[model samples]
Target chain A: MIEVSGLTKRYGPATAVDDLSFQVRPGLVTGFLGPNGAGKTTTLRLILGLEPPSAGRALVHGRPYPELRDPLLRVGALLDAGAVQGDRSARDHLRWLAASNGIGPRRVAEVLELSGLTGVARRRVGRFSLGMRQRLGIAAALLGDPEVLVFDEPVNGLDPEGVRWIRDLLRARATEGRTVLVSSHLISEMALTADHLIVVARGRLLADTPLAGLTARFPTLEDAYLSLTSGHVDYRGVA
Target chain B: MRRALAAEWIKLRSVRSTYWTLAGVPAAVVIAALLALHASSLYDGASAEAKANAVVSPLETVAAMIAQLCLAVLGVRSITAEHATGMLRTTFTAMPRRGAVLAAKAVLIGATGLVAGLATLFPAYFLSRWIAGDRPLVFNESTLSQDLPSLLAGASLVALFALVGLGLGAVLRNAATALGAIFALWYVLPMIALNLPAPWGPRLGAVMLANLAFQLSGDPPYPGALMLSPWIAAAAMFLYGAAALTAAALALTRRAP
Candidate 1:
């Protein structure tokens, strides 16, 4: 379980995430929805303790993230898809992350097969396509077999098959009683995958509701998301 | 902390630059030793004092310095590449403790420095002996003290530069600019300072790290005009490196990803 309370972050004159609070429970997939620059990424960073909160705190499994023993075993995070060293082969890339967490090389090979990256595992990450890099990122996240997983825009450039693969993978992990928090702009795909929704706009929480209620009230998930966030989105003039 | 160390080790092995840096030590040491050996033997017309002083000892220090650039680049690359590619956010997210992460990186760098020092010392010692003809170089007990300190100091300089490079990389986050600043501070500025007239000139040169480095080696134990004792100078350089690290950690940990 991930519990965040009164989380706030400000950048000089601009307040990025303000007084935000929410809980992401286990045994479900929680989709974090927000417009561009809505502080979705910032919120994840704060929760994972990548960046300190301006106010308040975030706890994972009843303890702060930094205080956790074997954090990789507790929280598996993929903040960006292409985070591996470009000159390193995909297999070597995963191997090091696994080693970092005391995970064996066998597990590294397992993630390689799981992510369907065994074929291109020997190829350098710099040469990978966007979809290939996405798989590598997911592979790294799953290396430690963590109970809570955080993915920021996992399906941004994936093909139809790749998208289906991730959807099934996330669902399977959730089925195993793991907590999953994924941020994405693809409301349609998220509608099918997410059990719960946390919507934000301009760094403020707008809605934290079940997916069924959102779809039942509005014709579709996208329509509901648009309605909730439309007012908060700023429209800029085209030059 | 153990896990973080293991993770950093994995990171060190995975990157090609790490190997490249390691490879440079031997290549540089061998080349510099050979060149110095050849020059000493060929210039027979030179004074006995010149010949004795002109042994491959100084060249080993120079080669070690050249090898350090590679290590510095590797050290900076360890964090900066992650920052440039946005991997550091993921690393912090995985590990979280700012001090632990920095500690892990420092351990890895120190281990690498020790290995690099050993590699350069042994080969340069023998190569100089071979090229300097029958007149023993490293066999003399008196010279061993000078040679060992120079060896250790050279290695420490490399490690120090690597740490400083990491700190600068953290502060600047741009590889090219950080490297440029390190190069100018270590090499260019020192050269310019050495040209001025003594008292002030030597004083100015004293602060010039390169000259300070040469003075600190003291193979023949030259008269001092520099800032601090060798140990103190070494400590001061490390302190500057630490400041860079502190700045970087503060900059990164406070800002949102």
Candidate 2:
């Protein structure tokens, strides 16, 4: 399970994630819902120990992520679909990351097949389309087969088929008693895939409850999200 | 540490540029050695003192300079490629201890630099012996044996340049800027150092990592108290490497993806 308490991240005077606290339990998909700049990405970065939190803590399996002896074996994360070297072939990219965790080449091939990227495994990531890159990112994330998985905007550039593939993959992983925390702006997809919702806005926790409970309380999850983030949206001005 | 080293090795090998840059080191060394030998032959009629001090020294210095650029390019390419392609984040995620990762990268680059340097050294020696003209260009044990320190120093400079490049990339996190900064430090800094006043100028010259490295290798026996001991030079090179690595680790860990 993933536990975050009073997690806060700030950029100078601008707060990206503020006093956010939520718990993601095992055996279900926990959807992290927030509008644009709702601190969704910042929260994930904190959880993975990619960025230090200004306050409180984010724990994976009862310990801070950096403190874990074998982080890849315990938690797999895909913060962005394009966080990979473009010049390297998909196979080699996964191969290196796998080697970093003491994982073998077989695991790399396993994830390629699992993410449906086996056919293009030899191609450099630069040649990949957005959808293909997303698949490769997913392949990298699953290389360790960890008990907890964190994905930010997993379905951002996917086709219908690709989207369905991931939805099924996530559900299957969660069904196997693993904790899955996914952040996205798409409410309808979350409604279809997530069992629980942890909503935040302007870096602050707005609600954390069952998906059904959130939908029942606010009419639609979209409405709930808007109510939380509507005020703090950074409006880009026109000349 | 072992796992991180293995991973960095794989990362370096998987990319075409890494191998290409590594290949360039020996290529530069051999080509420069050949050209230096050819040029040295033109000065054959000169006096012994003139040949040793003026002719061979300058030629060897040129060879060292050329080889150093190749090493610097390799070093900059190693880390800047990650930043350019956004692979650093993935790397950090896999191995969160920032210092360990940087150290592993330095170790891998250093080993690769040493091997490349050693490879170049033997080939250059043979090529120089073949093309360097008569006047009894000694291929004997004594003459060839004396050159080992220079070869070793060349290798150390390559690794040091690589570390310096890694540090520059870490600071700038841009390939173009890092390469430019490295060029400025390697090629441009010495010229500027020459224009400065008295003791300050030579002292500034001493700070030129590659120049000091070249001097460190030349004629192991010391004639004057002004010369720095080889151990002291090696320690200073290591100190610079450590400083660069510390900066890289801090920049890498503290910065956002």
Candidate 3:
């Protein structure tokens, strides 16, 4: 389980994530919803200890990420698919990551096969297409088989087939009693994949409800999200 | 820390840049040394004093100078490339102890530098020895016994520069900027210091990297300049490496990945 309490991240005069408090429990996909620049990425970064929180704390399994022994064994996160060395082959990339957590080549192979990257495992990452890179990133995330998985915008550049693959993968992971936290701006995608929703806008928590409850309140998940975050949108272009 | 070391080793070896830098630099140095030795042989009418000077200060030192840049770039690329590719986030996420990550990188690059330094220096020394003909060379039996420590100190200088570059890469986090700073510190500043007027010229030049490497190799200071003894010069270079690394560690831990 991931727990964030009063998590605030500020840059100079602007606050990116403001006093955000929430819990992402196991056995369900928690969709972290927000508009562009709504601090969804910042919150995930804070939770993973990639950046220091201006105030408050984020804990995974009752311990701060940095405090956890072998953190990769407890938490798997894919913050960005572009955060990979293009020069290294996919297999080599996963090999080193596995080594970092005392994992072996067997696990690396398993993840590569699971992610459908076994055929291109030896190809340089620079040569891979966006969909292929996304698969590689997911393979890296699943290498540790952690109980908690965090993915930010996993479907951003995916094809329809790739999107369907990821949705099925996430649902399967959640079904296996894992805590799955995915952040996305696609309301329809989240509506189909996420069982619960934690909506935010302009760094502030707007709503925390189940997907069914949200859809029942408004005609659709998108309508409920737009209503909740309308005032919180940081930028609005002229129609 | 052990796992981090293993990971860093894999990361360092997996990149083609590492192989190109490590092998290519030394290969170029050896080839240059061979060419220099061949050219020296054509100096048919050179006086005994000139030949003696050539034997005492082998052209291999010049080869080492060029190799220094290669090793420095290698060190810088090891860290900066990760930042450029945004792989640093993945690295830090997997291994949250930033200090361990930095330390592992240092160990990997430093060891690589040490091995590359020795690899280049040994071949250069032996080749210069073979090319010296009947003339007495620095690596001769008596000189080897007397100057062995200084020669090893010279080899260690490359490793020292690599560490400095690694630290600068961590601080700057950009390849071009870090490389520019390294070039300024390693080459430009030394050239300026050596050319300055009077007391300041020799004084500042004494601490310059090239001058220090020369002094640590049991060579005289740059013409009419003051310099520390061989051991003292090595110590000063070590201090520079330590300070740079300390700054790098501080900068790394303070910022968000």
Give TM per candidate: 0.89, 0.91, 0.95
DockQ result, candidate 3:
0.91
Query: What lDDT tens digits, residue by residue, belong to model 2 across residues B115-143?
Result: 76666665666566556655443332246
Q: Give the worst 10-residue stretch by lDDT in candidate 1 chain A.
A: A229-238
Please write out the lDDT profile of model 1 over residues A21-85, one tens digit for every residue: 99998999999999988999999888887777889888999988878876888888887887667
Which lDDT tens digits does candidate 1 get at residues B1-257? 88789878888887778887788888987786677556656656677786576433345665676767777787778778888888877677667776678778877886686577667765766566556656434333235655676677666767767777777787788899889988987778766666566767667666554544544565432344555577666666666667767876776666544
Candidate 1 vs candidate 2: which has greater DockQ? 2
Clashes of each: 1, 1, 0
lDDT of 3 by residue, A107-173 (tens): 9999999988999999999999988899899999899999999999999788899899999999999
Clashing pairs in 3: none
DockQ in order: 0.63, 0.74, 0.91
Deviation (Å) of B242 in candidate 3: 0.8
Cα error, residue A169 of model 1, in Å, equals 1.9
| Candidate 3, RMSD to the unseen true structure | 2.0
TM-score of chain A taken by itself, candidate 1: 0.97
Best by lDDT: 3
Cα misplacement distance, residue A129 of candidate 1 (Å): 1.1
Question: How far does residue A91 in candidate 3 sit from its true spot (Å)?
Answer: 0.7
